[model samples]
Every structure is written in structure tokens, then in C-alpha cells.
Target: MENTYYRRIFNGCLFLVPALLLCTKNFSIGAILILLLTATWYLIKEKRNYTLDKIDWMVIIILSAYFIANIPIYLSDMETTRYFKGASRYLFIIPIYFFIRHIVTETTTPRKYLDWGIVVGAVGTIVIAIYQFYVKGMPRVDGYLYSINFGYLSCSLAFLALTLANSSHIKKILWLSFLLCCFATILTLTRGAIFAIPILIIFSVIFQSKQNKCKNIFKTILIMLVFFWGMYAYSAQFKERINFTVTEFHRILSGDVADAESSGGRIQLWYAATQSFIKSPLIGQTYAQREETIRQLYQEGKISDWPISVKRAHAHNQYFEMLASNGVLGIFAIIALIFTPLCFFLKHISKSTHALTGFVFVLGFSIFCLTEVPLEQNLISSFYGFVLAVLINFTRNDLDNIQDSET
Candidate 1:
């Protein structure tokens, strides 16, 4: 009876995890609440003697390395509080990962509910985005969050729905959900997010092909390409954006430092970040020192245009940010964070649906992170951490066995 009660509460909290991610305001609150609840349940029910698994150790190693990278910040003249807070953002996902792993083995019903919750949240966001577009005449449909975040969330939903659509049961509803998510992502007008869709399609085709369904997956990819291209061709703003990007690319090659366009600015920032990394290649610099480093480079005429009037917080690219802030260790941590789960997913993809979903998400988010600092912010990081933990837990051997036996 006691076990049953704990199980009920655990399942209820798990259902709310993904739904809370859709809300901009309640995200952190929900994350804290869920983490506390999970921790409490584990201590009270398990008598405080839980052992760490290999994946758990991997996460610990990453977190430890991240903390070590931040140690130099305190020695510098910067405020250690900010760096400490930033380093601790990933802590919320650890307990939740253990809790979900425990519950998932007992039953698969929660997976169904979790999928439905994600779909409902996606629909809610889409409706709000449409309303914002039509009623307010907004330039970009940002949904409940910023335009970039909305694009990332929409991309996540689209891929999740695609995985569901590939399943034999309930294909019709999931296909509609996938189409809705794709439409929502398009409305975001975020070129980085838009670019990730094709990569996702290609990855999906490759994964399915390994399962000996290459012809079907290839046809689906072609259809998606046509629809996406049609959307681009029909939307005047999207076309203009693409043309602007191309023009900016040429300006970059011409050494036109005066081009303040997004693409050109990104190129400049990448160059600045690479310069910073070159100076402090091992441990890099603190946030304060990194700023000063960029400013110093500009003063030395190393960077063509420093935009002295504006303050630059990060390198715009996550890889560059890690190399600048955390140095080589940070780079290794980021790589492990990405590809460790990838190795597991690829190992189990031939047998488990959960593995396929994990692969799609990790691959898509990794590609998304290349150009944008999506994983650096609190809200998006929490979202990624929570979902990633759950998926990693899903990849456990027992659950895979359960899924295999049931199938």
C-alpha cells in the first residue's frame, strides 16, 4: 500500500514535467517542485541508500568538470555568485532522472501520458502563436516565449511527433500533430531552427534505414522537403530573410566590418571568441575576464569592429562560449553531454522506440546548439536537462527488456 501511494505521486509529477516546460513563467518553479518531490520520495522510500549507475556517473563527471572550470572565476575579480549559479543550473535534473528511471520500469503507462501531455502543450503553444500572429500583427510568432525559444520548442515537438507518427498505432493523430508543429516552427522565422529540420529528416531517414525501412523513410523525407520548400517559397518574409543572409555572407567575405547584419555579426563574434580561446586555451577566462579580453582585443585592433557601444555577453555559439569560458575541459564536458547518450541510443536503436526518440532529440538539440546558445539559458537548459534525463532513464536495460518482451 505504501509503495502504491508513492508510485501514484511519482507518476503524477512526471506527467507535469513536460507540460511545465511549455510555460515561460512557471518553468523554474515547476522544476524545483518536481526535483524536491522526487528527492523526498527517494529518501523516504528507499532508506537513503541509492547507488549510482554508469550514466549517473557520466552526468556527475560532466558536472564536476563544469564546476572545476568555474573555480578560476572566484580567483579573478569577478562576482563568483553569478558563475556559481550558472554552474548549478543542471543540478535539478539529477534527482528527476533517478525518479523517472524507477517508475518507468514498473509500468509503461506513464510514457503514453507523457506523450499526450507533450502533444497538448504543443497544440496550446500553436494556438497562442496563431492568435498572436493574426490579432497583433506580430512580425514573428514567438508563442509564449521568445521567437528563438519558440522555434526550438516547436522543433522538439515536431521531431517527437514524427517519432510517434512512425509507430503503427495512432499514426493519424500523431501525423497531424507533426504537421502542426512544423507549421509553428516556420512561423517562428528563426533561420537556425528552420535549418535544423532538414538535418532531423536526414537523421530520421538514416535511423529508419538501419531498421530496413529505408524506402518508406526516404519517401517521407522527400514529401517533407517539398512541403517545407513550399512554405519557404510562399512566405515572402522567409524569402527575404534567406536573401539577406546570402547578402551578409558575401559582405563577410569582402571584409566589410560595417555590415551589422546577423550573419556578419555572428562571423565577427566567432572570430573574437576564437581569439579569446587562443589566448587562454586550457582554462579560458571568467565571464568578467572574457569581456575584458574581447575589449582588449578590439583596442589592439585585432578585431575590426568591436561595437564599443554595446556589451557582448557571450560568443553567440555554444562551442565558442565553452572554449572561451571553460576552455578544453568545458569542451570535453559539452561533447560528453551530447555524444554519451548518442552512443547509447545508437547501440539500442535497432530494438527500442525509446532509443530512436533519444537519438532524434540529442542530435537535433546538438545541431541547434552549434549556432545558438540555447543550452546556456536557464529555461531552455532546464527543459533540455529534464527531457534528457527522462530519455536517458528510458534507455535503461530493464525498460528496454520490458519493451522487447511486450512487443
Candidate 2:
């Protein structure tokens, strides 16, 4: 009965993951509160159920660096803002690995159950994202599913769908669902995402390749491209974005584009971040400190007024954003935090191959994050948190296999 009660709480929390995601949309104080509460409840009642491995410590190390990046909290009001801003983003780290360890170590649930739940939920998200992107038309707020800032969530979901499909014998319904999801991804008109989708698919093909897998995968790709183009060929924005991408490629080849520079308005942000880094050099201007940093620089006539009001809330690049907000220490911490999941997954991938697919899925997300503040936005973050929580917390593979076999 006690075990069943805990499972009920766990499942209830699981359902709340999506609801809270929808409510707050991204990283939310409310969601964080709920997560912390859930963690506490488990610890207080089911004390023996709790376990955190080295991965948790690694996350702590990065987060500690981030916290240290801000000092004199009482001296400045913005210090609190910086703490929460960095902390909330970092908080997901707790739920992720800790939750996964708890699930895996508990040893009651079958591994296949977890896998199937992930497959079904992932496919469901793909379906909704597809309807939002391709058939129903893009939402005005999103410009595509989950907002324009990190709209690539749709593509990432499609990638997950494709990977799950690969792990099983192809069925007509599943294959058709995969193809529809693929078409939905392309409709978003997110250029980097368009390129990234193929990279993930190609990665899965290469990783899982067999004598016949390559041929079937290529055929699948061809069909996907044809169907996607057939549905959304009339979108001018998509065409223009592709053309701009081609132009950028040509510029790169001709030496017109500079590294850490130029692509939309990124070079400008990178330049500003660099200049800011130069002045502070140690502890950054702090998260809330950026506008003042700008104001001071602007008053001194060092930078133009035009560059001051950026649409990007933070520095456009994640690494540079940390540098701008928290300085060098923060930058390293952010990099490690963003990077460790994939590295850990890769390191232990020999123990579990399915995790490699999850790593590939994360790879596409990391790429999207490089140029855009996808994680900064609520919808994107929440979608990720909810899905990832499910990814890590779900257990019972026999149950997972049941869903897999049914499909």
C-alpha cells in the first residue's frame, strides 16, 4: 500500500508535468516549486526511495559555479534575479538524473515499460506538434509549435519518433505516423532545424545501420521530403529562409562570413558580449547587470544606441549569454551543464544503446540552442521539462514492451 501510494504520487506528478508545462510554458517558478515539493514529499515519506549518483554531484558542481558567479547578493537587488534565473534553468538538472536514477535503481518496474511510455508520449507530442505546424496552421504566438524562439521542438520530436520507429520492426500505422510527424517538422520553416532533422535521421541510420537499413531509411527520407514539400511548398518564408541559408553557406565559402560573427544579427550580440567580457573580465556584469553595462557603455559613446535594444533578452548565444551575464566562470558552468548530459549518455552508452538515441535527440536540441535562446522561452522549456521528466522518471520496461508489441 505504501509503495502504491508513492507510485500514485509519482504518476500524479507525471501527469502534472504536461499540465504545468502548458500553464507556465517554459521554466516557471510555479513548476520549480512543484518539482521541489514533489522531491521533498518523496524524501520525507519514502526516505529509503531516494538515491542520487555521481551525475547529481556533477550537476551540483556546475550549478555551484553558476551561483558563485554572483556575489554580494544583498548589495544588489538584481542578484536575486540572477540567482533564480540561473537556478531555475539549472533546476531541471535535479529532476533529470536524480529522477532517472531513482527509477532505474528502484528495480521494480521493467525497463521495457519505460521505453514504451516514452515512445507513446513522444509519438503523441509529435502528432499534436504536427497538427499545430502542418495541418492546423502555425499558431500566431508560436510562428510554429512551442514558439519561434525554440520552435525546433517540433523537429526534435520528429527525430525522437524516427529513432523509436527504427528500434522496432516497421508497422504501417507507425511508419505513417513517423512520416506525418516528419512532414510537420519541415513545415515550421526553421532553417537550422531543417538541416538538423536530416543530421539526426542520418545519425540514427548510421548508428543502427545494417545491410538493408540504409536502403529503407533513404527511401523513407525520400518519401518524407516529397510529402513535406507537397504539403507546404507554397510557403514563401520557408523558401526565403532556405535561400538565405544557401547564401550564408556561399558567404562562408567565400570568406565573407566570420566565425563568432554574422548570421542574422548574431555577430553584433557576440561583439557586444565580447566587449562586456573585456571590462569585467572576472565576475560578469551579472544577469540583471547587463542593462546597466549597456547604459554605461552607451553613455561613454563606446557602442551605438541601435545595438542597445536587442530583441534577444539575453546574449543571443548561450555561451556568450553566460559570459555577458555571469562572466567566465558562469560560461564554463553553463557549457558543462549543457554538455554533460550528452557526454554522460555517450560514456555509459555501452550499457544501454537506447540512451544513445536519446543523446542524438539532445544533440539536435543543443544545436538549436547555440544560435537561439530556445531554453529561455517558457513553452520550449516546459515542453522539454515535461517530456524529459517522463524520459527520466518512467520505469517498467515490460510495460514499455507491451505498448511496443501492441503497436
Candidate 3:
């Protein structure tokens, strides 16, 4: 009876994940429920019987290391929620991984609601973004989420939908969805996402070429290009963003950092972060301290004209943020956090059809992290955690035969 009840809750969590993603606060609550139920199920039934393999251990070690690295801050300054929230991110992978794995292994229907759930969420958001763009006349439409996160979600979903377009009947709806997502992404005007999606699409085609045949992938690429061209030609906001990017580059060249707020601000933050890291490279500062440090640098004129308002912001780059705030340990933990799943998914890419789905996810996150700290935000971070858990669990050998042939 307990087993049956846990299974039902597990399936419900899978469906709730995507639905809850439409709102950040609800998603947080939903994620907590998932963790609690997963813990209850594991403790009651699977604790002694379940065994983790090497990959699982590696993932857990990375997460634990990250958690430990943040302990110093939490111990020293228990006042702020920064340490708790930062540390909580590392906790997500375990319950999420185990819960999804249980559903896949013990249940007859695996990820039945998951794939469609993601699409349902994406389709609804895309429609809302469209309305915001045309009817609301918002230049950059973010839908229910922040603008940059909307861009990140759109970029990932566009690639995910591209992969799902492998089937004939589902292909048309997915392709249309993919196009709409691209439109929504362009409207976000997030330069990193705008740049990354094209590259992701090209690389995805190359990655799938062996299985998809060069001709079909090329045709799909061409169709995507035509869509991109249409958007580029028609979207005034897109053109203005591109023009602004060019202007920012020119300002950067002229050493007018203030005028290059869009791009140059990141460069200034990187400089400040690097200087701060040199002071304590082994075990970096806490989040609050880091903010204060940057604020001091800005005051000292060391950081030069970077606004004080955003000084409390972590380094815009994830790698830089990890190094600046968490030091060497955090860097190693993040490397493991990113690459372990990447290596696992890449290793199984050719063998499993769902492998690319997982690959594109990490790839999208990595690309986004290059410029923006996507992981720091609760919505994007939780979104990544939920998606990664589902996709990585899908990569298990138990579901190999059930893989999508399109991937």
C-alpha cells in the first residue's frame, strides 16, 4: 500500500514540475514537496535495498562538496538567507534523481507525463509571450518569468522541440512550437541566448547527423534558417538589439565602460572578481562579504564607474562567480557538477535516443552560464534541476529500448 501511494505521488510530482514552472513561488513549493515525498519513499522502502553506482556517487560527491564549501559562510553569518538558498541548490539533485529513477524502474509507464508536460508548459508560455509582444506591445516579452530566463527557457525548448520534431504526426506541432519559441526568444533580447541558440542548432544537427542522415538534418537546418531570416527581417526590436550590440562593442573599444553597460559591465565585474580572488584564492568570501567587497571596490574607484546598485550582484559569469565567492573548492565542485552529467550523457548519446535531450539541456545551461549566472536565479536554477533530473534519469539503461527514435 505504501509503495503504491509513493508511486502515485512520484508521478504527480513529475507532472507538477512543468506546471509549477509557470510561476516561480509555486515551483519552489512544488520542488520542496518532491524532495519530501522522495525522501519518505526512499527511507520507508528503498533505503537499504537501493545501491548507487559510480556515476551516482560522483554526482552526489559534487553536490556534497558544493554544500560543504558554503558551510563556512553559513557558520560565520547565519543572518542572511543567501547561504541557505545557495546551499539548497546542491540538495536538489539527489531526491530528484532518485524519485525519477524510481518511477522509471518500478513503474510501467516511465516519464509518460514528463515529456508532454514540458511541452505543455512551453506552449502556454509561448502563447503568453506572443500576446505580450503583439497585444501588450512590450518590446521584450518575458511571459511569466524574467526576460533573461524566458530567453534561456526558449533557447532550450527550441532545441528540445527540434529534436522532438523527429516524428511525422507530432513533427508539425513541434516544428510550429519550435518556431514560436524562437520568436519569443528573439523578443527577449538576451544577447547570450540570442547568440547561443544558432550555435546550438548547428551543433545539434552535426551531433545527430550520424543517425538523422546529413540530407534531412540539412533540410531542417535550412528551414530553421528561413525562420531565423524571417524574424531578423521583420523584427524591428531584433534589429535594434543587434544595432545596440554593435554600438556596445564600439563603446568597449573606445574604453567608455559606462556607455557599454550592456556588455562592458560584465568585463568590469570580471576584473573586480579576479582581483578579489587573488586576495583569497583558496577559500573565497561569502555572498554577503563578496557583495560588500565589490561595493568597496566600486567606492575605492578600483572598479571604475560600475554602478553601485548592481555591485551586490554576483559576477555575471558562473565560473567567475564560483571562483570569486566559493574559491577553488567551489570551482572543482562546479566543474564536476557540470561535466559529470555531460560525460555520462555524451557517453550514452549514440546508444540511447534520449541522450541528446539531456545533452542539449546541459549544453544550453553551459552556454547561458558563460555570460549570465543562470544558476543563481531560483526559477532558472530550479528549472534546470527539474529538467536535468528527468532527462538524466531517462538516460538509464532500463529505458533504453523505450527511447525516441528521432534522437
Clashing pairs in 1: none
lDDT (10s digit) by residue, model 3, range 276-380 = 577678777766667777778888876665645575556888878878776786687677667777777788877655677777778878889889777767666
- List where candidate 2 sits over 4 angstroms from the true fold: 12-36, 48-53, 62-83, 92-100, 103-146, 166-178, 210-234, 247-262, 287-306, 311-313, 382-407
Who wins the TM-score comparison? 1
lDDT of 2 by residue, 190-250 (tens): 5557667766776677666656877868875996687547544776656666676777767
Backbone clashes in model 3, listed as residue pairs: none
TM-score of 2: 0.71
Q: Which portions of model 1 show Cα errors greater than 4 Å? A: 27-32, 62-68, 74-80, 84-86, 167-169, 209-214, 257-260, 306-312, 397-407
User: Alpha-carbon error at 98 in model 1, in Å?
Assistant: 1.7
Residue-level lDDT of model 1, residues 1-407, one tens digit each, is: 76566567656655565555554465634745666576656766787566787777876664445556666645563655555454565665666666666655634535665666566766766786677766887878886678887888778877877775665365676667767777778788888888898888778777766555777677877887788678668888777777887888788789885574676666667776777678788777776666777677678876645434335446777777777776786777677667777777778887767688888988888887777777766667766676777666766754657777899
What overall lDDT, based on C-alpha atoms, would model 3 receive against the true structure? 0.69
**For each candidate, what TM-score against the reference?**
0.89, 0.71, 0.86
Q: Candidate 1's error at 92, in angstroms?
A: 1.8
